[model samples]
Target: MKKDKNRYTVFEHEALYVHRGEQKLSDAQLKAFQLFYKERDFPYYSLVHNGIRFCEYVGVIKVGNLTIEVLPKADKSNGEEHWRSILIDMMRSTGLFHPDSPSYSSLKVKNSTILDMYLELFATEVERLMHQGLIKKYRKTQSNSTALKGKLLIGKQVTLNAVHQEHFYIEHTVYDKEHLLHQILSKALTTVVKIGTASHLISRYKRVLLDFPEQRDIKVNESLFDKIKYDRKSQSYQTAVDIAKIILLNFHPDLSQGSSHVLALMFDMNALWEKFVLRSLQRNAPDGLEVSGQVSKDFWTPETGYTKKIRPDIVIRKNNEAVAVLDTKWKNIGDANPSDDDLRQLYAYSRYHNNVPSYLVYPGNENKSLSGMYSRAFVGDAQTPGGVIKLKVHSGKRDGMELLNQNISAILF
Candidate 1:
């Protein structure tokens, strides 16, 4: 890989001094990195000075057009390649992204960088989508025209404007093939042309995007993607649509709120880890348990209205009762024990969910243990049935889902 002298790289969830030998980041470089650093919500990257540390979730981030890949830091014994494998496994556990997205038989053989993998997968999906052709919808357009079209407006407004102007208020049905998916793909391809490293692949995608006429150069914003829905008729478009969604979500060239030249694309490990755990439990919960996320119940219902809904991450319901509440934290639990804040939160969950078992799951070393605690002050009436907070420092060293199952089995089965 060709190196850019100006480019500075860092690892995910890592802390390091931004220095080369005795020389630190120039004032301008510090300013630029600080902007993206703050945007990621990473704590303390705001302190832009010598030895100022920065870390964030995994993905290729950008400051302007420069790439800053946040690979998970690994020791010499394991290295980043192994960690990437684990990350991929976590993704599969979620059942969100396709298992064989890159369509490669094995990761070991591919010897591909993460960006390479993303690019290859995107290219393949685009090729498949283009082969299927764009989806066509007969959209009805209304206009005041010289001649009648599909249907003429025969109301008072027609007489007020169309008749006086000697034109017909018409609704016309036009169909070919132009949609937000293609427009998003076109914009993403434009990004590739600007920042992509692979010359051959960039050329290929550029041609595919340019194949459409000028009318299809359709600029798409985030709101456009939100209003779109897919039904059975459009189900075939799911793969391409998903790819476009990921691409657009990660890439932002000229956002309305930020600098026109600013670029930052990253994934939050906390969110990803939480989702992975939820999916795992959803798939493996006991026969009686139903795994649900963002489970909320009103804490206070006044005479007028309700307030303060306590929503926990994952709640295990059995026989329409919350049996357990699970909160997955991305931090490693080896060095740091569960915090007072975490314990208090779990205690609150215990009260909110009728004193059910609550868990705080975290990354751990090989030797892991579960700890349980009780809070008398939080839940006032001793007579009420539920309120136990349990914490498990589960090992992320091996198969994370398996580790989770082993930990959760003690409480449920």
Candidate 2:
């Protein structure tokens, strides 16, 4: 089966080798090759497997002597449903089973294996397609037939009485009387002083001024008390003021301000970084893959009583397998590597979820190596290769997302 200089390997009754070189494949040569290898598992198999008419007429692949054709399988009676069931069953048997296995019971036994095998292959192709940015992949929703329904409210607005009740009426009055000396003085003071200062003065004098005459101030004993004047109240007030000043001065405003800013910025950066990570996950996941963002899991211990809850940034599921868990850390996870707290958290997630692999994704620092931790203890170093992964979000010259995609693809596929 030699047509050209390039050798095409065929896995058939015999492993036939063909040289397809300078000469282009003839129609008859392609048709013969397709018919011979139509049902076989190879790169060109998809052309024929898609349909018989497709192989014969649209010839996606060149076969020996005969061009491949694809024809749509007949959808009479329950043929389509039967085939779908068969595919599901086969997939289940081959370790790619959906958790909801009963859904495939209606599918035909004969078509199940073939369809399932094709689905497995399709999954791989879908992964490749997603990586190449040639196609968009979405996870199939569990409930395909469900539709959201909007409720319509048909009603009229009810009118209420506009009259205010005697008790309900709130009187907000502003009286301007330049002729009233006390009122004028109060207004002038309010206008001149800051709101805080005015409020303070009003509060201080509120108890003393029960009546207009009670506001009178008596003259101090000047000459008689001048010699033996003991200023007790003034001395106490001065001492209290000195103590208050010392307390205010002791307050470390800079430390508090710096911490507040750092926390705010960390959250802002984390939010942006998380979005990028989610996009990368969505882009790389295969069709029928479900991704959950910020999934929380709560664990309770006998000693601690619901010790803590962990929220992984991303949790990806394929064929109902809790495949990967990713945590995004915005902090500079220095070249020295993740702190003990980080390792404990990730390891707890893994241990809690039956040893699911966990990844700690951080901003790329050229100095750090993607390493693993080995201990459950939060303090000291324990072991090597504890199944923890430190994925650096690569630095400089290359696109971060591209690097992320590459790393994810390698890990997932």
Candidate 3:
């Protein structure tokens, strides 16, 4: 990184005194003075006389005298502009700025854009803080009244009465600064990984597809298929499948009999998770593999005002056939296995995609035994298909890319 000379006072002094000002001094003397100044503040008279020469040597500000420098102290407004510029640069460095055409100009910096960039950088933390109820809003009001009578007015010219009232309120939420800062840092990290992984997958797929277009086809004869399936030409397909599986595993909701609360949380997480997954697939999937997110299809239903609209998280297609339908849920899956709701949703996805095999993925517990639950549920039962399979995602302990690799391997192979 280039040093920001303007940031330091010594450089500023040197620029002002030696370069911009008419201060005259021998090179050796100037060097000696600078060295002395580094140890302690320059005496007022020496600075006054030599400040110009000193600044010229340093190459920052032009110094006129001890009391005055050509470079004035940054005023509040100028300082604000400088801070804003720094923030814009930060945004550009963080990939928030457009590479092709710069969004920031030399003149005015967009306040809204700056704010949005800050929010994006700190959304996760902000959201977490909000969830903890660390921020709150309230309101207040006031009123007054009086009374009157017709008899009073008549009596005396009588008695009389009157009334008056007033009301007002103000409201806003206060945020915990410490908690907000912590959350922002945490979320920023998570956003980077999520974004980076997606980008990598997309780039990888684009390269493979460009290299081998033939591998994009979904339907292939058994003999030729096995030969090219694991070859370099098929790398894009493999990557797409892998990325999709990982997304499904991390984002899928857990389903159990009559558990509305867990299901709701699962749905919320799935919304974000699926979006990331779709973006990744789009970035990396070969042209042959048609990857789409939240695809909506409508069919007439029993109700007059309602139509059956199906939106699948991911639909991976090869040729005309919908090869796979993947739905992500954030719910934790237990040993008890797939519930009726789980089966029903997958079945719906399959039906919507013309009987395609649908996968429902959820997070799995690390130290728990799922075998016992499976055995109990399958006692004396033959291998009955058309049910959801439970996949455990140990995202908390493992690398995201590695976890995704495992998911893709399971999905494709």
TM-score of each: 0.74, 0.31, 0.32
Model-by-model lDDT, in order? 0.60, 0.38, 0.37
Cα lDDT of model 3 by residue, 129-172, tens digit: 33444322122221222333111223322122122122112222
Of candidates 3 and 1, the better by lDDT = 1
- Write down the RMSD of all candidates, one decimal each: 5.7, 35.4, 29.0
> Which model, 1 or 2, shows the larger TM-score?
1
Best by TM-score: 1
Task: Return whichever of 1 and 3 wins on TM-score.
Answer: 1
lDDT of 2 by residue, 1-413 (tens): 22223222211111222233333344444444444344333332333322222211111122212221121111223333332342233223323333333223333333322322222232232233223332111222211112322221112111121332211212122222211222222222222121121122344333222321211122222232233222432221222122222222211211322211100000123554565666776777778888778777776545745566777787877787776677766555455567778777777766655566677776543323365655546424433343323344432345444676667666555
For model 2, the run of ten residues with the poorest summed lDDT? 258-267
**Candidate 1 wrongly placed segments (more than 4 Å):** 1-9, 15-29, 34-47, 50-56, 72-78, 100-115, 140-172, 197-200, 212-214, 254-262, 300-306, 375-412
